[model samples]
Target: MSAAGPSLIEFVAKRPWLKKALTPLASWYGNAAGYRQLGLRADDLIPEDNERNLQALSRLPPKEAYDRIYRIRRATQLSLQQKILPRNEWTKPEEDTPYLSPIIERLAAEEKERDQLDTLGVLKKH
Candidate 1:
């Protein structure tokens, strides 16, 4: 499982009406979370204390890694000053795309597969 825990994204997505109904709620929740005001993407809020996230961070492209670091540092600075980015400078909805999440999910899947393989047993021919 991902550090974020099991997600209902796939479940919601499979049903168009449910996804449509939840779209505004999700947007409102995202905005209310306030990370965008700090100029940070949702992915940046993910804790890096775990091995999977750390590995995923390491796999990010050079530009993406650099941008993530810059955003985090800037957010830290802004937080210390207790200020949010100007409205114009806040991260737009489109800009809040997931960069690290796919990698984390892939890593989790690989780990699960590895565990399954390691636990497999073969019977000897009689």
Candidate 2:
């Protein structure tokens, strides 16, 4: 963090290839004792309370540098078609990459079906 906002580590700014390995940490440090006591799972994205910095940081991205951002953006776009999500509200563990597609598809399908039923004539008993 600096006068402007959370500055990207020099590693990220200088080395494009390192993007694959970089992860965005929600906090500045993890206290191992506290972490062990709390049993923290690693993959988490805190909501950006400082939305201005988030907006600025968006432009600095080597686009796919943050998988969570990429996934969230995709989900938001898909939600427009399916109506399954609010714009910024992403699934917990939003970067659970291997399972995200299936989860999104299932939810979106359910939402679409519900919307369809709302438009179509109702079922009496069946």
lDDT, candidates in the order shown: 0.94, 0.44
Q: Which candidate has the top score in TM-score?
A: 1
* Residue 40 lDDT, candidate 1, scale 0-100: 95
TM-score against native, each model: 0.92, 0.22
Residue 12 miss distance in model 1 (angstroms): 1.1
Regions of model 2 farther than 4 Å from truth? 1-45, 51-64, 83-126
Q: How far off is residue 5 in model 1, in Å?
A: 2.5
lDDT of 2 at 11: 55
Off by over 4 Å in 1: none
The local lDDT score (0 to 100) that residue 29 gets in candidate 2 is: 35
Cα lDDT for residue 69, candidate 2:
63
Clashes of 1: 0
Error of 1 at 57 (Å): 1.0
- Kindly list the per-residue Cα lDDT of model 1 for residues 1-126, writing each as its tens digit: 346678897899999999999999999999999999999999899889989999999999999999999999999999999999999999999999999999998998999999999999998999
Model 1 misses residue 76 by how many Å?
0.8
